[model samples]
Target chain A: MSKSSFVAEAVKKYGQDRESLMPILQYVYEKKHYLSKEDMQEVAEALDLSSADVYGTASFYSFLDTKEKGEKIIRVCKSISCDLKNKEQIISAIESKLNIKNGQTTPDKKFTLLETNCLGWCHKGPAMLINDNVYTELTPEKAVAAIEENL
Target chain B: MSTDKLQKFKKRIDLIFSDVNWKEILDKALKTSADDIIKELIASCIRGRGGAGFPTGLKWKFAAQQKSDKKYVICNADEGEPGTFKDREILDKQAKKVFLGMAICAHTVGSDEGYIYLRGEYKFLVPQLEKELEEFHKELKAKKLDFKISIRLGSGAYVCGEETALIESMEGRRGEPRNKPPFPVVSGYLGKPTVVNNVETFVYTAMILKDGSKQFCELGTKDSRGSKVFSVSGDTPNPGIYELELGMTLDEFVELFGDGDTKAVQVGGASGFCVPRRKFKETIIGFEGIPTGGSMMLFNSSRSMYNVLHNFLDFFCEESCGQCTPCRVGCQQLLKGIVAVKAKEKPSKYLEDLKGMTETMKSSSKCGLGQSVPNCFNSIIDNFKEEVIY
Candidate 1:
């Protein structure tokens, strides 16, 4: 299946209405891991919306990355609760294991590291999301092990 | 049920986490008339659990009265407040209740469609929730009801928790708030009459419909009726969720949940008030005092109020939609102002100007996100001035 056809399938799964723009973008992003210029343009054309409008909506959400992302995106919780629990240590553990800093993608394109505000798991802080899977109550060892599982 | 010491403190209730017969609940609520359901909700006095504390009954009633061909019921599962996380628990434990609550509202308001806007962070729970939604639809169909509920995932943006902004995001637009007056109850969701409620609030409605309004009303104080779920975290042995009876004084709350060395408790979330040690006895934890959306973050003596306040300001700066000037600019300036104050570059007097700007944002900002910033800002600065200044 070609890229444009995948988007066409998503447009069919959800309607072509204005409301379908978000689901369509999400579907496309899930397959490609990010929305490139052409993917967003195709979504805009399919939904009969401006490319800028599609771009604006995608940019508004932290999960709807408009830029490039690797096969797996790791979002470490940086909110106050997670911060107090030493999220820096958790990030460092992943950073050393993956050989990439925060907001950077690995050379192999298998992992991307980023920090996010509150994943709603404050009680079990030091949490991170690898793609849609959530790992919580992470010690440095546990965080590294979770990343290693993906590897 | 109150003892000498316990009377001075909070009263814990077991209704929220207690067991329920969903089959019976569905049978009773579905058979009840729409008017009676709204009336019982009014009598129950249950308010929105999303921190805004709007009357849940009045919202359903207003949406019901609106004359539109299409109506909507939205369960706001976008739980992104800094310290709050009870909605996720509620959905995890009693998802059917949330769906049934939407079904009840749809029947009352004469609507056939509903949506649950779950946050992107909670995407892991999607499979189970979707599975339950299918079962819920089957139950509704067995009763021959016309209501249908679907789940929508919200890409992480805290401002989308606001109702109009949630509606806008549902329409595939930016999650920025719309101007008020024509609230979501009147003009919403494809420009139709709609009812948008917090995830926990919907659960409460389902419970209320089961046990009758009088039982729920009798639980809490006059001003705040029924129990509330509190997302308790930070500086405590017990750092999880609890459903306690409302009207507890802060002193009682601190006594129950605070660590031995606790210096303050940030009631609600970052957008909530900061109660220092001195004011705990006088502060109430309900609508009569400082109402919370159920975020109670305790801080021990070792932690710095400056750091806490800075964390919140940094969060606001990153999350602000940048549509409104007061929130977009005011958040950055406040964060910068504090750094300058702490470094002694700006005089201690400059904090007052920042306070003035918060007041301005409170009055002029487009939505609740900007308006409520003053709650944490003022309370933290006023209570922890020495920590903030030098």
Candidate 2:
């Protein structure tokens, strides 16, 4: 389906009320991996909201990235629990494996690695979120293996 | 120091994680009058398990008293605190109880609509939660209850865990908090009379009804009643969730969860207090000494206190919704202050100036995130002054 139609479909599915804006934005964000200008404009027009307002709300959330993103987004948990568990090692491993640094998307547009605050998997530290899936208790080997599956 | 105190330390309870026949509890709650249910809740002495320690019964009663037809009950599943993951565990394991608890509140507060503002990081659990909600709606229909629950997603904003911000996010806006005076119980979620509670708080409300008020009230101390679910992590041997009765001293907690070389415990999360080993004997893990939203992270001698402090400040710097000046500026300045002081850019006495800034933030900041930054800041700096300075 066309991206504009996808946004229109999200608005229809979630309803045109003010309450449905987050779901609609999330629907588009997940499908497109990020919200573009046209996508936000399409959503705003469908919801009868201003494009700036739509962008404002989208930009407020970390998950609703305004930047261009890859097919998969890896958000590593960087909070203290994960840090103590050597989260840095996990980041280094993924960076070398993908040949990209943290906060940079791979050249092939397959993965974007970023650091996020506590993923609420404190007990199982060194956790990461790839798209929607959660990978916890990560070693360098485990993180690479998990990323390899997505490839 | 004393065996008598040590013996009373770790009383592991199973009210939260245990499998419950939720229908029996719902039938009992549904049959009882709302006033009577409120009375039982009050008598049970269960406070909001979401760290604030507000009386849960009073919150329900206030919403019940509101003369609005469209009262809403929200389950705050935005579990964003650093070491706090018990809410996720509860929702993952006993979501049925959480749904029923919301239904109980809905019936009590005279509302038909409910929402669970789950964090976006936990999107992985959405499928499981949706499955539970379907079963819940079916159960509600079978019982002929005039209530329905919907799940709303929070897009990676920690401040949304604050009830007003949660309400704002639900209304499809920025998650920055609003001023108090019209708390969520009175005016929340599209300006309706709303009751917002933590995942564990709702489960306890249901569990309170299930076990009767007397059973819950008998468990803990006067100030903090009933057991709380804690997300224990860091240097602990058993790093996971555990439900224990409130009012245990820090010494007792460390004995059970701490490594022998434990240096300090970061009670609560980034926004919670830090307790060193010297004061562990006197520090009670409840409202008396320090209140928490169930995040207990241990630190051993191997770790540097400076790094921990830096991480928390960095978190606050990012998570502080930039709407307010004190939080936005204060967080950035505090982070810079620590880095400069460590690098000898400023004298060590400059730490005192930074301490003054936290006091300013504690008073002037708009929300709990900024206000509570001083909790760990003051505690960690004061106790680990050498580590922070050197």
Which model scores highest in lDDT? 2
DockQ score of the complex predicted as candidate 1: 0.85
Clashing pairs in 1: none
Off by over 4 Å in 1: A1-3, B1-12
Q: Give the per-residue lDDT of model 1 (tens digit) for B22-118.
A: 7678888888999999999999999998999999999999999999889999999999998889999989988988888898899888999999999
Q: DockQ of each candidate's interface versus the true one? A: 0.85, 0.90
Question: For model 2, what is the error of residue B368's alpha carbon versus the real structure, in angstroms, after optimal superposition?
Answer: 0.8
Docking class of 1: high
Model 2 segments beyond 4 Å from truth? A1-3, B1-12
Total clashes, candidate 2? 0
Model 2 lDDT at residue B219: 80
Candidate 1 whole-model C-alpha lDDT, 0 to 1: 0.90
